[model samples]
Target: MIDLESGYILRPVNPVFIYFSLFCALLLNLLPIGNYGWVPDWLIVCIIFWNIHQHRYIGVTWAFIFGLLMDVHNSDLLGLHAFSYALVAYIAIAWQKRIVALSVASQALHLLPIFLLVALFPLLMHWILSGEIIWWALTGAIQAFIEALLWPLATRILLAPQRRPIDVDHTRPL
Candidate 1:
């Protein structure tokens, strides 16, 4: 029987690490990659990764705040990132258990659709709001693919510590 209850034991996580990582993601997103039109949404990637690992605790609020920051940094429409990240957060939170149950690669596969949806939401919203079909918006598909490709690598790097036994002093008996 698969022991689903045997989730990894973890040490108390410092919230600072999460915030610092988000800050790093913001910095990454600010890099000059606009010429490709498929710039990775670093903050969304981080938000979704954490939402999978931390579930509801890392949900809509973080998404909204970071999205707003991203919008300001990128000088896009004000709520573009906000709406996209919030929607993605809700999806991630809703599917957290099922996705987290899978191995990292499987999780990345499942996340592909979610990432694509997130990439397209803002474009769809802009089309509706501006009353014009944004042809260039289709580039979001490439952006989604890039983000999906990144999920497993980012998950492995960030969650590696969670998968390992917490370092303990051997002299102390449990």
Candidate 2:
């Protein structure tokens, strides 16, 4: 499909590539990097990328499953990450059309708020349950900015696989 707005012709995405990317993102998130508030959530970034570009294949259900896995890995309250992931997935889906139409740079601007909500959901939930706010968690907002900043680069990398060959041949007309 040729994106009329972006002028990029994209071939059908390989299911294998999608799964591999998601798995890699999950592994990255599961790495033993201490709970650093500024570290961007690689899994969610991957999820959002697919949500915007391949929503039919990657949706909220996938997000929930990845969230649950992270919850187990982190040994945190079960379903907390699941809920946050699903919430962000839903938001991304809701705005997928608009996000898809924008330039990659503009798309980052739209994602900033979605990232903010994802970053804050955990802290808000924790405060409500424990009645003690973890002020350090507030720094997680920085992760959102970092993710937004990297959006353009991420888009280029993720879309690279699907971009049609620039030199069209009669044998392959995408």
Candidate 3:
């Protein structure tokens, strides 16, 4: 009996906030710690969040650009991150209406597969290139789980600025 309906009525999101959040996420992803298996891709998380919540402002193009930046930062295969990011963005946008209506936990469950795909891309690419499947690459599943766990928190924080005050007073029109 999970509730698909969201309780809050959010105001229009500010374009500036979206950009600032994306910038912060990119900076976070650039941190050296991000390369570790324990750290989920912050940029990808933000990109998916925006794609699901604010499709008009953020889309596949943004994901591709950020992915390219990450590729350069990691010096990994060119377009690897870009392609995965674009794929994630496209999926999120495609499911935007259904996802937005779900409870945060439900949304996380729905997003798990997309995150897994993104996490496994590197391992998949490596296997394709070297003709060897690395069992250690399963650790990427941990990162995918972490990303899924982060969805509720991300939804809470990112939507805070736009949420209408709980205690609506006559003094406030909005």
Please tell me which predicted candidate would have the highest lDDT against the true structure.
2
Q: What is candidate 1's local distance difference test score?
A: 0.78
Model 1 residue pairs with clashes: none
Q: How many backbone clashes are present in model 3?
A: 0
TM-score, one value per model: 0.84, 0.92, 0.90
TM-score of the candidate numbered 1? 0.84
Q: Is candidate 1 or candidate 2 better by lDDT?
A: 2
What are the lDDT figures for the candidates, one per model? 0.78, 0.89, 0.87
lDDT for each residue of candidate 3 in 80-137, tens digit (9 for 90 to 100): 9899999999999999888977788889999999999999998899899999998887
Q: Give the alpha carbon lDDT tens digit for every residue of 79-124 in model 1.
A: 8888889888998989987986787778888999998887888778
Q: List the candidate numbers ranked by lDDT, top first.
A: 2, 3, 1
Q: Candidate 1 — which residues are off by over 4 angstroms? A: 1-10, 168-174
Which candidate comes out best when scored by TM-score? Answer: 2
